[model samples]
Target: MTTDTQTQPSSDPRYPVGRFHKPQTIDAVAIETGLKTLEELPRKLRNAVADLNDAQLATPYREGGWTVRQTVHHVADSHMNAYIRMKLALTEDAPVIRTYEEALWAELSDGKNAPLEWSLQLLEALHSRWVMMLRSLDDKQWQRTFVHPEHGPVSLQTGLLMYDWHSRHHLAHITSLRQAKGW
Candidate 1:
């Protein structure tokens, strides 16, 4: 029986690299690896969106997801918050970190229509400073903790892992789209 039925892509397009899962323990090796990933993110991300035109950038990686443009800007916005959170954790005793509505942030005009270069450049500079800060942290500093209203009591090590995974996760979203579309 040859009944025609359209088959959609098997995988979840929104999470091409799967979701982030915090590790049970954060060791020196894990910290080293996470730092390496953080260092490489700016370059990896830049390469992902390179040569993409406005129309291509406007195209969503998934059917009902933010456009590539929004994704890039969101990375900048999110990473900025993370950098500040790191600083706060270093200074305070488990400070409560603020959370914003990322979906709403993506709807802002700058997120939707601003040039990707702005975010890319911001990411590069921010990451450079962030990497420097990460490298300068002592063992005690890495043990610093922050409280998220939702997650609660996030250590610096976990924060590092989360952002490292976050970098790869979002990069995969764009790269997978490029491969799927032959871009």
Candidate 2:
């Protein structure tokens, strides 16, 4: 089965890559592909927004949705949480991970108005560290689990794939808007 990045088109703009569905079993190739996706996300995202002006950046990707600026910042925010959660899972036994209201976080000042450069830089640095940690893990470590307050126990493998989908999902938001608006 394909990951969200490979899914067929959907009508929902909010889920351009399609929604993430945890794979029944994550094999070595799936893990490798996920790692590659994680590594490419910052570059892909940067290219997606590089040509936009302040007005374009401030334009919402969809009606009643986050502006392109907010989407860029949100990816950094969300991925940072994923990285920390992975660390917590690796270091503790079934650590109960904290969950935040992402919509609320997106509405915060930094998410709404921060320069895209700040978040872009954060994604580069964060993904570099995150990929380093992911590469260092052995089979046993990959199987480590973390409990989320909302989703119960989740394996490191699942988390990796989820974030891979997440990276594409938001990037698609920007690209699709660019296509629709001819930006």
Candidate 3:
């Protein structure tokens, strides 16, 4: 008879916030909205895990998913790569950005065991700088493209949207886990 997030599992735990939608048309308003998501992630994610002790941090958001600790670290990892990719796209023409094994990265010593403070602090600083640069991009600059070896060419507008969705996506994982476990 009880219907709460804890009692009712989301349709797909992997995508509590739903998947990212590639926009048919991305304008400045859309870019600004995405920037807000980017701007807010550090504070939002930090608060999501603020009170969780190490034991809770080690709990996975879902079956076969990254633990909360790894999730936080992974955000730092992924966002760092994104920041660099954006920089490269702006400086170089259709730069071929390198890819990484995100799953494997999540299993590394830093990702798996390092204090969340380190990554949280890094995100605060990284997002600050990233937002500053993103805000300065002109309409012509937003059209800049970067090529992921696998995903093909990605415009800055699209990157902004994806990372914005990504910001919400991963944050949902942690929050949804907390709700489910009644933590």
Candidate 4:
């Protein structure tokens, strides 16, 4: 018989799907406030994740899906890419951020087999550097723009807001999955 795990989707998709479908739109003031919230996100996420054990971290909500380790690693990878994009935007005149096949990255061996500790460490370091980058940006730097081939024009402000949204969204997903499984 097919179990619940066989029928369900990964928790990460529950909220972040909206971000993928609806591109971010925000004003500078909103971006500033959102960036503040984003800066606090790593500590909040680490706190939330602290209660979950390695099994919980490794459990896939569904079959043929990523476990929590993969999800955390994906966050690190995604944030690293965003940090690089922000740097490019500040340094270049309307640079286009390079896109990669996210699905392919999600399927790599590390994604499939890495220990939860590695993903957690990556998340910690990635968020540390990303927050530093955000904190260092002046108003002009925050306003820097880049063209994403798929998402059209994106500003560092909007990207920061999106990253803020990203952290909470994934945290919610993780919480929901844990509740569903009573873990």
Q: Provide C-alpha RMSD values for all models, in order.
A: 7.8, 1.5, 5.6, 7.7
Model 1, stretches more than 4 Å misplaced? 1-10
My TM-score estimates for the predictions, one after another, are: 0.92, 0.96, 0.94, 0.77
Q: Write the per-residue lDDT of candidate 4 for residues 89-146, one digit (tens) a residue.
A: 9889989878987668978987767765676676777777777777788778877898
- TM-score of candidate 2 to 2 decimals: 0.96
lDDT of 2 at 86: 96
Enumerate residue pairs that collide in model 3: none
In Å, residue 43's CA in model 1 sits off its true spot by 1.1
For candidate 2, which ten residues in a row score worst on lDDT?
A: 1-10
Q: Which ten residues in a row have the lowest lDDT in candidate 3?
A: 1-10
Q: Give the Cα lDDT of each candidate.
A: 0.86, 0.90, 0.90, 0.68
Model 2: per-residue lDDT, tens digit, 143-171?
99999888899999889998988888899
Q: Top model by TM-score, which number?
A: 2
Higher-lDDT candidate of 1 and 3: 3
In the range 66-101, model 3's lDDT, one tens digit per residue, is 999999999999999999999999999999999999
Give the local distance difference test score of model 2. Answer: 0.90
Kindly report which residue stretches of model 4 are placed more than 4 angstroms away from their true locations once superposed: 1-13, 16-29, 51-55, 62-65
